[model samples]
Target chain A: MKTPVYFDYAATAPVDPRVVEAMLGLLGPDGDFGNPSAVHAYGRKAAALVEEAREEIAALLGVAASGIVFTSGATESDNLAIKGAARAAARRGRHVITEKTAHKAVLDACRALEREGFEVSYLVPDRGGRISAAQLEASLRPDTILVSLLHANNETGVLQDIPALAAAVRRHGALFHLDAAQSAGKVELPLEQVDLLALSAHKFCGPKGAGLLYVRPGVRLEPLLHGGGHERGRRAGTLATHQIRGMALAFRLAVESMAEESSRLAGFSSRLIEGLCALPGVLLNGHREARLPNIVNVSVEGVDGEALQLALRDIACSSGAACNSASGEPSYVLRALGRDDALAGASLRFSMGRWTRVEEVDYLLERFGSELTRLRRIAGAA
Target chain B: MDELHDPARYSPRVLELFDRPARLGPPPGANREGQAENRARGSWLRMYLQVEAERVVAAGFHARGCPHTIAAAELACEALTGSDASELAEYRAEFLEAALPLPPEKLDVRLLIEDAVRAAAHGRR
Candidate 1:
């Protein structure tokens, strides 16, 4: 048996071998390893590959290549989109909106904006972790300049109704920024209503250190980095030719196989969730039908979250509690949905991906059930 | 290996007890039991001791907490068994601290174990 079978794909998928193969062509002396900004022949070759990758990624996303501004992965992309859009539109309004359960990148970015004298309204999602369209509409103010939200939540795999939320933001004349790091390649991104969208290649089996933010043609953004005139003055770092190539190729591959892969993963998710919920005191964490197909989160009662994780040492899964020896903090995402600190900490998040096997899923279910029972028995809950 | 299971994060003794806490659950012929709970951290431990002729003959416990807290309970129970009942009053969580090598954040957890042990002793009179 493979040791530590991975089910934490939502954290980051292993880089596809194809992506690795594509990246290798751009490195070393014989490859096109030249500064993309130079007018030399090598530079021109490198630049051409970057442009080709841009076009490839744009085609997969069904958007114009010119709209894509490549950055150093989702965290930077998210910071750039939220801060850039908010700062660019600051003269128009000082108010922004997001949900309480948004990723730390999004939440911390909004918090930083607040320090800059911008007002932010963090709307609480319903019990099922859905930010209703009506709830968003009521929060929109005349001075609301930007509304940043996630298409799919990272922790619970719960997807927000982007189309409805986008329409609400559109009617209120606010620019909508989406942190689609978790949703891109997994779901169809309805960008027609989105003003800015953030994505990380690693989320879809692309290389690390590669990501992009799509800014609609007319959307103005204040540049986050300043020095070089790269990315048409939006992002200013020297282009990472290999990482970008790998990211584009990975995105294309994932999107190409999206339909079939979505169905397959949905089946796996259903099987895993069913097996988990069958266990005594185990609960499915997110909405049954309204979540991403690859991610399954559940909280097991009467087991220490850390102990349960240790028991399943052979299964690489995540606990809702971040278990540093010093601090045991429950996931704020779970807390936002009204889960108590204990249950939230005891939660497990198993995210399957392209490499996941049905046999591995069954093995996980079996191990999870037996280990849970043992832990409960030790805790005297059985 | 995940960092949570890293040997550096916890001692071998801690993992040993956590994997198979031999003193878990109520011991047979237990006339006294005491429990302690940290509602904020969501850690709880119940210690059951069987005392004969003012000396602890057996000690066991059930706990819900991180590995450190659970290990501390198991260690406390092991130390209490076959000792004079007055030793329960003298037993310091500090001893388990060195045995489990608990961090400062988990100091309270060790104290919780001590509280349970002292409670079991208090129930005798």
Candidate 2:
């Protein structure tokens, strides 16, 4: 059976073997089984390893170890960052700002905040999927307490200018939080100036169940999930030593290989964009130059994304976020970027990864061209 | 090979009944006469069928689906012809027993034939 290529790395990535190896010791009987908060020597060993891993991840991102707090993954981190911050800052202002295309975690948290009576402004992006820095500045009101924007879009790979937008939010005294789930390991992030930021290890070849939330020293957040008070009262749980170690390894590897992977994936992404663009009536969804090197979103008219997806069973792609696949609605991201419902519904998000090969790309191009032709015929356009 | 185009494997019983492919049915269409002549009020596999009782005429159809849907549409028109309310009202999926049975997933197509028979028989055919 012929299967399509796997081009949905932005959704999730296959954990590297190195991460698995690092995790083994922690899961085994010989590993650090004791809790970090315990008084026993085994607990001390485990606690030290967790702290070391935190430092490792911090080093990779060029941040202080004290600023990094471990969470279950990106989703939890986003919730803790937005909901926690919004609720804590509710006394100051109940109004907050964010782009409509943010990952569901951010949006859901904002929605939950909305239920609690905090007003949220979901900024609509321009045609290229960029939330203009000026628009963000304009949206900030005296009542707005926080501005939460994504670092890189999960569906379109659209990269937002963090420092620029953060500066705008800073002027209004609202906290700035960045969801770097898709950008953290693959690209450089401006973590130094931002009040808060979130990251997940799995997006960058790290192990699953490991993520980081960066809260500036002075920022205040009400904990979203209550537990044993493990993460300096910000989060409470026994740290998963193996997951943290694996994440630290993955983070270090990603940082060290960034220069290499970025260039390589950029080349592959360029080839993909060029090949797809050659087809008639196809359009690009995100800012061509302002997006991540590894992601490309394309719209092929006269093709049903679901049908094309079903037809290209071998090549794994995502029409939108993994969370919204069941809804089968047009991508909210593309729609925010001014895409019509039909065009948004017809889009395909192909994100390149560390293991992507030129041959696989070539195969995808062939498959896409053929599938587009067939779908058009079925729709009577061809 | 396109296994879809060959009609030998399928049947033209629906088209044979209406004996007309006027591009209009009970839902909506360009020809007022053809649409008005068939009350065929219901949904075909791809088309919507509506029948008018007063004139025994049927008209108008809208097909927002595929070829199998369009073909089943043609099947709908056949499933309703030369019959009045009592005669064609009894037609059922058994009517399709002699023709190509759609896969389990394509039951929507069968629905088209059923509605067509009821509407055309009781409608303004």
Candidate 3:
């Protein structure tokens, strides 16, 4: 058995070999390394590649090619979607709505708006990390012009009922922004009513420095960056042809294989959950049936979270969101779901991906059980 | 030493002690035990001492904490094993802290260890 195994796919996935192959074509001197903004022949060639890739990504999402605005990645896309839309509609309203379990990108973007005097409502989710449509509808007011929420919770893989939530926002005439960073290319998205959606390329095995935000036609959003009017004046940096092509190709590949891949990963997820929950005092974190099949998060009662994290160094799993790991704080997402700090901090999130095998899952389970027992004994809990 | 060392986060010495804390669990015929908790970090340390003739003959511990806290307790047990029982009254984690260099964030674990030693001393009297 490999000493160190990887199970933290939700943090970031290994770049697909196909994406790497396609990206190489546009990077070297012999490649199409032309400035996409240039009016010259090389520029035209690069621009054509970018547009084709855009069309492919857009087709995968079932949206118009013109709606996609390529950005650095999901962080930028989310910032652009939330702040850009909020600032553009400031005259219409100063209120925005989001959930407690949103990604920091969405939450922080809302925070920035709050500093600018925008009133932001952070709706707490149900104990299962779910934000109901009625909860959202009750919070929406005449002045609430934007509602930003993620389609799936990154920490626990708990999926929100986006269609129902989006309908509530629509009824209030507020623009809905979906942070589909975890769901896109992995699940079939019902996004016909979503006005703005954020996508991270790396989440779907694409390049890291690439992502896009879909801006529905007729929705006004102020540009985040200012320069030569790239991305139709929505995002202004010079286009990265290679990254864009890689992202597009990666999305296409994921969507093409999603059906079989989802089923395979769901099976792995089920087996892992069963093995883990069978242990005494181990509690599953998310809604059992309403979560993404790739991520399995559970809390081990009476186990030292930090010690458990240290012992499981052989398995590349997370105690919480990778972004917040350095802070040494209990996951705010779990706390929002009413888990005490002890249980919240003790939680482990194991996410599987395309390359994960059943053997690897079994190895993780075996290692987890032994480690739990050892740590419990050390703590005098066993 | 296992592959658990994140050099930026933990010292090799800390990992060594955490992995194989030989002094862990109650020493044979321990008559007094004291526990301390750092609720903020959700960590705790319990220290047990076997005292005879007003001298600590054996010491052991059980802990639930980060590597640094557990390692500090392990080192604490070693330091307590041969000391006069009264020394626990004014025991400080300064020696343990010096032996195992820690980052600024984990400095509180020292206080927890000190509190456990004091608690053990209080229980003995």
Per-prediction TM-score: 0.97, 0.79, 0.97
- Clashing residue pairs in candidate 3 are none
DockQ of each: 0.67, 0.07, 0.61
**Candidate 3 lDDT, tens digit per residue, B8-85?**
576778878887888878888788789899887788888898888989999988888877888899888998888989
TM-score of 1: 0.97
Stretches off by above 4 angstroms in model 2 are A320-324, B1-125
A best-first ranking of the candidates according to their lDDT comes to: 3, 1, 2
Model 3, A71: alpha-carbon shift in Å?
0.6
Task: Give the DockQ of candidate 1.
Answer: 0.67
Q: Could you give candidate 1's per-residue lDDT for residues B1-125 as a string of tens digits?
A: 54546676677888788878898788888877888888877888888999889899999998888888878888888888898987776556688778888877678887798888888887642
lDDT of every model, 2 decimals: 0.88, 0.73, 0.88
Residues A1-382 of candidate 2: C-alpha lDDT, one tens digit per residue? 2344678899888898888887887887788877888889998999999999988877777878888889989899989989999999999989989989899999998999999999999998888888988999889999998889899998888899777887788888999999989987788989886888998888988887889899888899898767887788899888888888888998888888999999999999999999999999889998989989999998766545544554465688787421135564568788888877667767788998988889999999998898677555433354
Instruction: Quote the lDDT for A340 in model 3.
Output: 90
Q: Give the C-alpha miss distance for residue B14 in model 3, angstroms.
A: 1.0
Query: Tens digits of per-residue lDDT for model 1 on A60-92?
Result: 878899999999988998899889999999999
